[model samples]
Target: MRDLNVCIIAFSSTSQSVNLYKILKNKKYNVVMIQTPCTISAGCARSIELKEKDLDAVVNEIKQNNLEIKGIYRRVLNDSTRRYYYSEIDI
Candidate 1:
């Protein structure tokens, strides 16, 4: 199978994460609430997950609303090794 690439939006606070989840859900975006990965230290335990293809739109939504975020990341899951790799996304 092909690798899966996901976009992770880390928030400074749990409330911010949940608020963004709500906003995205209401806007009909496919998103999920997730625990922040240990590799990312800037955010709280809660974060938001979405498809990599939606990253730009999500980022735009965040900016248009002036929501604060700790950082953004691209997570890739290797199907063969069953390992996940993370990289910070510049925004």
Candidate 2:
């Protein structure tokens, strides 16, 4: 099995999602902007993906920058089922 790295940032609005994406992207992380996955919902229609190792910094940026975050979720994709397990983060 292979491991996938991602961070699902649930924002209060699409605009906020875009802002978050910009901030993360500027940090030069492997970021991908996408809609909230079908199987998960933290109240955001948009999300950004980054390396798992960068999760802490990203979370810190959001908090430090006072970004409005609905929630942040981590996931381990079930390769066989091609689905993600939504889980919370302590940060």
Candidate closest to the true structure, highest lDDT: 1
- Superposed model 1: Cα runs more than 4 Å off: 1-3, 78-81
Using TM-score, give the best candidate's number. 1
In candidate 1, the residue pairs with backbone N, CA or C atoms under 3 Å apart (3 or more residues apart, or in different chains) clash, namely none
Q: Would you give me the overall lDDT of model 1? A: 0.86
Error of 2 at 15 (Å): 1.4
Candidate 2 lDDT over residue span 18-81, tens digit each? 8878887787777888878766674667877777788888878888888887777777777898
Residue 56 displacement (Å), model 2: 1.0
**Residue 14 in candidate 1, Cα distance off native in Å:** 0.9
Model 2 residue runs over 4 Å out of place are 1-3, 79-82
lDDT of 1 at 26: 99
Q: By summed lDDT, which 10 consecutive residues of candidate 1 come out lowest?
A: 1-10
lDDT of each: 0.86, 0.75
